[model samples]
Target chain A: DQQVKQNSPSLSVQEGRISILNCDYTNSMFDYFLWYKKYPAEGPTFLISISSIKDKNEDGRFTVFLNKSAKHLSLHIVPSQPGDSAVYFCAYRGSTLGRLYFGRGTQLTVWP
Target chain B: EAGVVQSPRYKIIEKKQPVAFWCNPISGHNTLYWYRQNLGQGPELLIRYENEEAVDDSQLPKDRFSAERLKGVDSTLKIQPAELGDSAVYLCASRLTGVADTQYFGPGTRLTVL
Candidate 1:
């Protein structure tokens, strides 16, 4: 069973618009959630993260919202740019062993 | 500082052959992890090491896979008699001990077993 899931396989948006990616998890033991952006031929790079204690975390144009009760989270990019087009993955940091469980990922395309 | 480094960006071999992928983590990082990412899937952890000791390898297929981290800085993962299902991208990540749970990843080695 997949503990984390990204139901949307891809999302496309226009430049200067908002891009929202959704993710859900079944495990309650996950306390830390993070977003990673990956480009072609490159490894994933860390983006914004939100702890269980906070409902939202923002970094520049990226914002992540967490709804612990519903076991859902979403990453929002405001005024998305072309460079932001890539595969976005959501990960949960397991309480035990400190390992991360990742979602399949969402391919985001920001058009000019 | 240089990010994690992985060699053999791409490899193609017939089924039942042996293949190996190498990784060099960032300097002074004590925690290293190896993950396998199949097509259209996210990365799954195969093994984890704290320094030279392998702390977790429950997901690794020991029957045909082996890994070693000799000096706690660089690691090598080998698959002997690789099967067609073994085709995937192998990623290496490292993190400093006691730091935030962020992991720095390498470019990854894409392996295709024909």
Candidate 2:
């Protein structure tokens, strides 16, 4: 069974607009959540993260919100640029072994 | 600092062949991880190492897959008698001591078993 899920397969947004990606988890053992962005034929790069203690975390134009009760989280990018176009994946840090359970991932396209 | 490096960015071999991919992590980083990613899927950890010791490898297919991390800096993943279903991207990542929770990923080695 997949512990983390990203229902959206793809999303398109205009440059300079807000882009929101959503993720859900079925495991309560997760205490840390991270977002990674990946380009074609490359490895994933860390974007932002949020701990279970906080409901929100922001860095520059990127912000992540987590609702523990809902078992849901979202990543928001304001003034999204073409460079932000890539595949976004959500991962949960397991309390045991510190392993990460990743979602299927969402492909985002920011049209210039 | 230079990022994680992986060699043989792309490889194609017929089924039942043995293939190996190499990786060099960032300087001074002691933790290494190997992950597999399929099309439209996220990365799945196959093995994890802490300073040359494999701390976790429960997800690895022992019958045909094996990995090694020597000197605690570089790693190799090999698949013997690869099957057509083994086609996927093998990604390598590394981090510092007690910092393996957050990783820096390599470009990955794409493998296609015909």
Candidate 3:
């Protein structure tokens, strides 16, 4: 069973525009959420994370908003650059531990 | 600090052949994890180890797959009589402590079964 889901398979955005990616989860026990960026043939790298208590977290040009009641979260990247064009994965950490459950990933293409 | 290290970035083996992948975690890290990632999908945990003890391995296919972290440091994952379905990227990650810690990932070893 896929506990985390990224409904959108792909997204295209123009350079310097805002890019939004969404994720949904089925488990309520997850307390920590993380975003990862991946390039082809490479392992994912941690981008940003948020604690369950917070509804929104921002890191420079990236921001993550969580809605516990809806079991959903989103990542927004502003002034999207060509370098930001990669697969974005949303993952959740276990309540007791840091084990992660990941979504299928969304491929974002930023056209310059 | 050096990140997790994995050897043999790419491998291609025939079905029924034996294949092995090696990993060396970051220095001073005590928690190690193994994960399998399929194309276009997210990674799934294969096993987790604390020091030299395996704490979780429920997702591992024990029939033909086995792993060992003998010295509480470097690890090896082996598959015997490999199958086509086993083709995927195997990633190794290391954390400084228990589950709540952040994990650092390696480049991963991609296996292609012919």
User: What's the candidate order when arranged by decreasing lDDT?
Assistant: 1, 2, 3
Docking quality of model 3: it rates as medium
The best-first sequence of candidates by DockQ reads 1, 2, 3
Per-residue alpha-carbon lDDT of candidate 1 for residues B19-72, written as tens digits (9 for 90 to 100): 999999999999999999999999999999999999989999999999999988
Q: Could you give the fnat of all candidates in order?
A: 0.74, 0.84, 0.63
Error of 1 at B19 (Å): 0.4
TM-scores for all candidates: the values are 0.99, 0.98, 0.96
Expressed as tens digits, the lDDT of each residue in B19-78 for candidate 2 is: 999999999988888999987789999999988999989999999999988787789999
Instruction: Please identify which of the two predictions, 2 or 3, would achieve the higher TM-score against the true structure.
Output: 2
Candidate 1 segments exceeding 4 Å error: none
Question: For model 1, how does the per-residue alpha-carbon lDDT over A1-112 read when each residue is reduced to its tens digit?
Answer: 8899999999999999999999999988788999999999999999989999999999999999999999999999998999999999999987655588899999999999
lDDT of 3 at A93: 85
Each model's TM-score for chain A is: 0.97, 0.96, 0.96
lDDT of each: 0.95, 0.92, 0.92
Q: Which residue pairs show backbone clashes in model 1?
A: none
DockQ of every model listed? 0.85, 0.84, 0.74
lDDT of 1 at A1: 80
- Model 2 chain B scores worst on lDDT over the 10 consecutive residues at B94-103
Proportion of true contacts reproduced by candidate 3 = 0.63
